[model samples]
Target chain A: MLSVDIRKTLGAFQLQTAFDAPEGVTVLFGRSGSGKTSVVKSIAGLLTPASGRIALGARTLFDDGSRINVPVHKRRFGYVFQDSRLFPHLSVRDNLCYAARVSDRGGRSPDHVADLLGISHLLDRRTHALSGGEAQRVAIGRALLTEPDMLLMDEPLASLDGPRKAEILPYLEMLRKETGLSILYVTHNMAEVARLATHIVLVEEGRVVRSGAPDDLLTDPDMVRLLGIRDAGAVLSAAVTAAPEDGLSELAISGGRLFLPAVEAPVGATLRVRILAQDVILSTTRPEGMSALNILPVRVLAVRRGDGPGVIVQLQAGHDRLLARITRRSADALGIAEGTECYAVMKSVAVSQTDIAVGLQSGL
Target chain B: MTDWLGPEEWQAVLLSVKVSFWATVLSMPLGLICAMALARGRFLGRDVLNWLVHLPLVLPPVVTGYLLLLSFGRRGPVGSFLYDTFGITLAFQWTGAALAASIMAFPLMVRAMRLAIEAVDPRLEEAAATLGANRVRVFSTVTLPLILPGIIAGAVLAFAKAMGEFGATITFVSNIPGETRTIPSAIYAFLQVPGGESSALRLVAVSVVIAIGALILSEWLSRRVAKRISGA
Candidate 1:
């Protein structure tokens, strides 16, 4: 377990955050200038906190009260910056070996990390010649060669284009699963959070407002406000119950049944489904002859106004609270309020297969 | 055919080369240190140190030479103390001429090196620190290699400036044949005599050739270093 409870004051910005991350990918999610990078830097010992205690497992990395502050180099935490920060004078091979040669820990080898990151072919090339995705891959390899106890990635994909981000996400997922290295990933992108995060720590104004499983927070109404109305959604874990012949697959969510576009996963395999708030339509009574394939009988739990002209309706289908956004006029016409009964209607084709991600075991 | 250059012209050529070479070699390390300090160090009186480093550039060369002579001449306080303690002498010697040339050229060397050092990204140093390199090791392996082109440029500028140094060398060390006489001093001597115009013109031509050669060599060295560092 890696735990950080730090408080630092820099001019006008005050950072007082406390969070314990288990041995998995704990993503710090927030908008820009929200102190996400500050928290990660504090954990990596790049920025010293005025007063706090930082510990990783049995070792005490920092304690301001005791006047114990380890230097950044000796802290032995691998940090991958957004710019990659590769040594311009060194070849890719030398850049990968730099940390390993200097690290006090003797377990990690440079060749092993290079092989793991799949950059053996580009080892002899200069750093400036590599593409953006390739540079990040080499940066990851350089960090891993240090044999750090934990890894801190600060928006490593923010500099890349969307396609480049897509190219690197799978490698990050592989790193998380294959190495089982405790990772503290900082990102502002919600799509990455939905795909890779096991736990999400919501940060705003230099403070952590909430921390929990990704599915729990992704559907929370308060979290929807943090993520904004356009990106609000419900993350549901489902098991592929059956693969029907009509290009649709039945999924068993916690509260009700969901039908998604045909997925390649075999029957009985678990998958995650993301149903966007804007895509959901609520009706007071069961409608007939509609093309929508899935409808859940739900009770209106709460009603709240969104950022613009829309009203957010919280519904309890089974054990999950699904959010739906509709204009205020529609809410009034449909008479949607708390304790009202409604059928949540969504097309099977609208439940995209790409949104259905398969999660691995917790430790993996 | 006999050699075109006369004996006096040849002496001036040889002495100028020796003086400028020694001046550049002696001042390069000090120039690098001062450049690094000015570029990287954050300390009290940094602006004052910066002004002092550039003082030789703005001040008249004769004034700078006079100051050096006051501090380093055999009879002056610092000079006399050294002479009394260690029997060292710098007044009216070729070494004094070299010292004057170095002092006059120091600013150019530091400016080139400072620009080069400043051009390097500090983020790379931070990255090196995270890689477990100490401050000294990071500077040696990363900072020095990155700034090498600037160092070469600075050295060449200093050497070229040392070759043409006149007012300072004459004021500090004086013109002594076979001792403190360099190209500029020899030119001055030939100008003083009505019959030595041809020798002075030939010596001036040699000076021009040396300056051009130094500039070409510096360019070649800088490109080689840049290519090596950039791995291109």
Candidate 2:
């Protein structure tokens, strides 16, 4: 377990947060300028907090009250910066082997890490010649080769374009599955959070507003604005139950089956699908002859009114909670309230291909 | 070579090479230390140290040499102590000429090295530290290699400066045959006599060729070192 609790003041901005992240991928989800990087830096021993304590397992990394602070190199936590920060003077093989030699972790070999990161062919090349995604993979490999107790990534993919991000995400998933390395990843992008985060800590204004499993906090209606209203969505863990029939595949979700437009996943593969709140429509009565392929039977959970004409409604279909944003007039006219039964309608094409993540080998 | 240059002129040319080579080599470690301190040290008196390193460049060469004579002449305290303790004499000796040249060229070396150190990003050092290398290891492994071109540049400047050094060498160590009479001092002596212009010009041509050769060699060395360090 990696636990962090600290308080620091940088000029007028104050950082005060506390959270315990378990062994999987714990994502610090926030917007830009939300102190996500600061939190990661403190945990890596790069930024010293004014007070409070941080510990990994039984090891006390820092304790201001007792005047205990472990220096960065001795802390044994690997850090991957957004820019890669690879030593330009060193070859990719040497860069990966650098920490391994200094760290005295002879268990990890350069070839092993290179193979794991799919950078074996690029080992002899200089860091300046590698692409952005390839360089990030090399950086991650370098960090892992140190045999650190935990890994810290500060927006590792933020600098990449759409295709580059796609190129590197599978490697990250592979790392998450192959090695049981605990990761503390920071990002302002919700797509990464939905794809990789097992535990999500929502940070806003240098404070953790909420912390829990991604399934629990991501569906909360009150967090719509924090999640970016336009990008605000719900991630539902589903299994590919049937093959494509007429360019549509079926998924078994918590509530009922959802037919999406030609998901390329194999049968029995678990997928995480994100549906935007704005795309979901609510009806008290099931409408006939609708072009939409999905109409989940849901019971209203909560209604949160934003400072606008629309209201964010929480609906529970079976054990899963999903969010739907509808106009206040439509909500009032349909008499939507807590415990009210309704049908949530969604079009097959409304779920973009970019929003689907093929989860790990094991189902979510 | 001897058809145009006399035996005495040959001795002066060879002696100048010896003096300049020693001056460049002997003062390199001290130059690097000064450069490192001036570039990265945050301690008190840092600005004073910087000013002192560059003082030789600002002061007249004769003044610098006179000051050196007052402190390091044979009868001077340091000079007397060395003579009594180790039977070594510097004043009016070949070693004294080398000492004078090193001092005259020290500022140029330090300035070149310091600029190179300043160009190095401190973030790279921090990254090295994160890799578990200590402070000393980081400097040797990450910093020293990167600043090699600068060191070479500094050494070359010091060598060329020492080769051409005349005012300081004359003030500190008087012109002595086969000892203190370097190429420049030989030219000066030959020009003082009647029918000596041809000999002086011959020595002048030799000095020009040596200086150009040193410049070209230093340029090539720095480029090779830069390519190897940057892995380009």
Candidate 3:
């Protein structure tokens, strides 16, 4: 576990934040200029806190009271910047070996880390030649060679485009499975939060307003405004129940069987699929005519009316919770209230390939 | 067959090369250290030290040579101490000529190096620090390699400046033949004699060739270093 309680004043803005980072990927999720990056910098010793204490497990990294601030290099934390800060002068091989030369802790060989990140082919290439995603992977590999107690990633994928992000997501998932290293990922992207966050720390104006498991906050109606109406959604723990039929794989989610566009996994493989609130449609009563494939009977957990023309309706479908972001007029017309039964409708192909991701493998 | 340059002219050419080489080599470390301090270090008298470095460029060459003669002459305080302690004398020697050349070229070297160091992104150094490198290691592995092209440019600039150094070298060392007289000093000597235009012109051509050669070498070296660093 890593503890951070830091207060810094930058220009006119004052950043005061406190949080505990437990095991697994604890993401510092916030919008731009929300002091998320400042918090990460403080942990890396790039930015000093005015008054606070930062501790990593048994060792204390910083304490303003005691005036004990360990230098950045000795802190032994791997930091991945938003821009992959690879030494342009060095080959991929030499760049990975840099930390090993100076550090006694956890510097692994370039070949071994390259194999782990699937970047063995890129070892001889110059860093300038690699694509954005490829560079980030190499950056991750270089950080891993440092053998850090925890990884600090400050929006590692923010600079990449859609296709590039898709290419790198699998490698990130692989890291979670391959290593027991603690990661404090920083990003404002809700999609990344839904996909990668085992724990989420939401910051607003330099304050952590919410902290908990991804499942709870994702489904909470209050978080809808922060996670933008279009991006806010429920993440379902699902498993492949049947093979692809008509180029669609059937997944057994909590409410019912979900048929998605051919998941690349065998039957009984567990995954996490994000159902964007905007993709879901609410129905007052069961009607026959519909082009949509999946419609589940849901109970309205709560009604959160927004300042805008929309409303985020918290829902319960079997053992899982889902959120449907509908307009206020639609909510009134359908009379969605707490415990009110409704059918949540969605198209068979609506769940995007990027939305469906790998999660915990619970005896699958 | 032996008409390319007079024997004295040849001696001057070789002496100029020797003086310029020593000047460039001896002053390079001080130039780099001062440049690093000016670019990154924050300390008292920093502005004063910066002004002192560029003083040679601003001051007239004759005045600088006079000051060197006063302080580093055999009878002067520093010169007497050196002569008494180790029996080493910089006064009226080829070494004194090199010292004058180095003093004149110091500013150019420092300026080039400081610009390069300032252009380097500090974030890269920070990244190295996080990778478990101390300040020295970070500088050696990251900062030094990144600024190598600049260092080369500085050294080459100083060498070229030292080769052409005239007023200070002549004023301080008195242009003694085969000892302190370099190419420029030899060119001046030939111009003084009646009907000596051909000899002076020949020495002038040699100086031009050496300066042009040095420029080309610096350009080629800088390009190669950049290629190796950028890995393109």
Q: Tell me how far candidate 1 lies from the true structure as C-alpha RMSD in angstroms.
A: 3.0
Quote the chain B TM-score of every prediction: 0.92, 0.92, 0.93
- Among incorrect, acceptable, medium and high, the docking class of model 1 is medium
Model 2 interface DockQ: 0.51
Categorize the docking of model 2.
medium
Model 1 spans with C-alpha error above 4 angstroms: A240-252, A255-269, A284-287, A296-301, A306-308, A316-321, A328-342, A353-364, B1-7, B216-232
Return the lDDT, model 3, position B155. Answer: 93
Candidate 3 CAPRI assessment class? medium
Per-residue accuracy of model 3 over B42-108 as CA lDDT, tens digit each:
9999999999999999899999999999989999899999999999999799999999999999999
The local lDDT score (0 to 100) that residue A259 gets in candidate 1 is 77
RMSD of each: 3.0, 2.2, 2.1
How close to the true structure is residue B101 of candidate 3, measured as C-alpha lDDT? 99
Candidate 2 per-residue C-alpha lDDT over B1-232 given as tens digits, one digit per residue, 9 for 90 to 100: 8766899889998999999999999999999999999998999999899888888888998998888788788789999999999999888899999999998899989987887788777777777776677788889888887888889988998999898999889999989989999999999999999998988999999989878987887677667556655546
Q: State the weakest 10-residue window (summed lDDT) of model 1 chain A.
A: A355-364
Sorting all predicted structures by TM-score, with the top scorer first, yields 3, 2, 1
Model 3: what TM-score?
Answer: 0.95
